[model samples]
Target: MVSKILIFMLWFLVWLLLSWPPRISSFITGALVSAFVSFMTMDILVKDRPSGRSPLRYLWFVYYIIIFLWECLKANIDVAWRVLHPKLPIRPATIKIRTDLKSDIGLTFLANSITLTPGTTTIDVDKQNGYIYIHVLFLKEGCPDHDMRLPVVSKFERILKKVFE
Candidate 1:
């Protein structure tokens, strides 16, 4: 019940944020939409599980968002530098990386994070074996060493493991 309310409130807040200069009519509409969606999806959203009930977990999710934004900024700058440089210093490579995340939600989050970044795209995911194939725009020389871990991938996976697993 509490989780349902939280999900409803989250959805309404997002709607409000997206609908700038919120009017009374928009507020009512957002409320109705949020309520309907929440009622329909609460079970799937909250998973009827007790693991993520703590307020501390919410705080951790906020912390993860901050870290993700910072990484996004860095990736944007890196990609911009590569694009504007005279030599076009790009060493593209498709590499297979192993993840420790067990849940589908966690793995999906990791994959989306990789794709959201400027220079990396998630090519494929092998959920059974816990492998994600990613294509990177700027690869260092002597890369693709099977055991190498990319900073963006590893850091986001570490944070998401805490958030989702």
Candidate 2:
């Protein structure tokens, strides 16, 4: 029931944003349309089992998304500059990265994030093997493998675990 409400609220807010105020008829039409859409969609969709965590987890999820948006904006500017420069200082390479997230939503979020970020693309996800093939624009020698030796979960994975997990 809560998930249905959440879905409805999300759609309604998106509708309101797309159809700004001062037009009363449009607002009413949008709200009714969104409500009907939300109702039909909610009926077709099944909610995932709750994680058994506190509801406050949602607040943390919002925080992670806000932080990620800033990172994405910065990456876009950097990639745009590289594309405009005559040198085109970019080294394209494919790397296999691992992620700890075990949920479909989590994996989808990570994949979408990588695709959204500038100069990076997610080619495929090997669910059976737990790996993702990513094409990086600026691939350094050995990547972070030798330097920090940290796991290759990507920055987005870190936030997703906080959000959907």
lDDT of each: 0.84, 0.76
Measured against the true structure, the TM-scores of the candidates, in listed sequence, are 0.80, 0.79
For lDDT, the strongest prediction is 1
* Per-residue error (Å), model 2, residue 127: 2.0
Q: Candidate 1: which stretches are off by over 4 Å?
A: 18-29, 50-54, 142-148
Over the stretch 11-130, how does candidate 1's per-residue lDDT look in tens digits?
Answer: 999999999899999999999999999999877888645354455766788888898788789888989899899999988889888889888788888998898785899999999888
lDDT minimum window of 10 residues, candidate 1: 48-57
Q: What is the lDDT of residue 41 in candidate 1?
A: 87
lDDT of 2 by residue, 1-165 (tens): 777878887888888888777388877887798889898898666466656766776887788678668868977998999989999999888877776777888888888878777667889988987778888888767674843222334566776777677
Give per-residue lDDT, candidate 1, residue 25: 92
